[model samples]
Target: MKPVLWMKSSCTTCRNAKAKLAELGLEVEVRDYFKKPLEAGELEHLLPADPAPMLGTKSPKYKELGLKDRHLSKAEAISLMVQDNNLLKRPILVHPKGTVIGFDAEAYARLVR
Candidate 1:
C-alpha cells in the first residue's frame, strides 16, 4: 500500500495527521505541497479518478480568490492548482483505492486500517 501524504510543511493540521499515521506504524512517503506540489496529472496518476471539483484549498487565500465560487472548467481548475499549490486541500492521503483530503481523523482511520 502506497501511503503517500501530501502536506504543506507549515500546516499544523498536516503535522498532526502525519503523527497519527506514524503512531499507527505506517511508513508514509511525504510530498512537500509548497516546494514540490502535486500537479493535476499527478492527481490522475495517484488518485482513483480525476479530482475535478474535488481538488481545492479551504485556506483563506483560495477562498479569498473565490475558488469555491468558481464555475471553472476542469482544465481551468487544474491550471490554477499548478500555479498555486495551496489550492490543494492539505494532507491529501493518496491510497491505492482512493484519497483522503483535509486530515479527517475518522475517515483516515477507516482507510489506514
Candidate 2:
C-alpha cells in the first residue's frame, strides 16, 4: 500500500516532510488533517495505544486546553484530538514498515525500503 501522510498544510515542518518524501521518490497520499478533521476511530487506527506521541504539545490549542497540567488517559487524549484536530502533531507517516510521528529523513527512507 502507498504510505499515508497525515499533516497540516500550513506547518513548515509538514511542508518540509513532503518535499523530503518527494526527493526520496515517494508518492504519498497526503491527508490534510486541518481541512478534514480526523474521526475518533481513524485516530485510534492510525495512532498507537498511547496517543501521546501523536499529540502536539506545542500547539496553542493544547495550552489553551491546559492539557499540560492534567494527566489524561489514552481515551481522553483521543477524545480531545477528535474534538480538536489542532491537538494532533503534524506529518504523521503511516507505512507498512511502521508509523512515524514526525519528519525523520532516515526513518522515512527505512520505512519505504
Candidate 3:
C-alpha cells in the first residue's frame, strides 16, 4: 500500500509535515483526519498494541481529561481519539513499513529511501 499521511489540515504542524514530505520528494495520500476521522477498528488496525504514541497529549481535551497522570488501556485510548480527532496526534505517516506520529525529518526521509 502507498503511504498515507493522516493529519488535520488546519494545523500548522500538519502543513509543515506535508511540506517536508514534498521537499523529500515523497508523494503520499493525505487523509484530513478532522474531515474524515477514522473509526475505532480502523485505528486499531493502524496503531500498535500501545496506542499512547498516537495520543495527542498537547490537545486541550487531553489536558481537560487529565490524561497525563492517568494510565489508559489501548481500548480506552482509541475510544477517546475516535470521539475527538483532536485527541489524535497530527501528521501520522501510515507507511508500508510502519506508522510514524508527528514530523521527523530523518524518519520521513527514511520512508522513501
- Model 3, runs deviating above 4 Å: none
lDDT of 1 by residue, 11-113 (tens): 8988998988887776789988698777778854544344443565565657887766666566666677788776667778777756777777777777756
TM-score for each of the candidates: 0.79, 0.91, 0.94
Worst 10 residues of 1 by lDDT: 44-53
Better of 2 and 3 by TM-score: 3
Could you tell me how far off, in angstroms, the CA of residue 92 lies in candidate 2 after the best superposition? 0.3
**Evaluation by lDDT, superior candidate among 1 and 3:** 3
Off by over 4 Å in 2: none
lDDT of 3 by residue, 50-73 (tens): 777888889999999999888788
Give Cα distance to truth, residue 112, candidate 3, Å: 1.6
Inter-residue clash pairs, candidate 3: none
Which residue segments of model 1 deviate by more than 4 Å? 46-57
Q: In terms of TM-score, which candidate is strongest?
A: 3
Candidate 1 TM-score, C-alpha based = 0.79
Clashes of each: 0, 0, 0
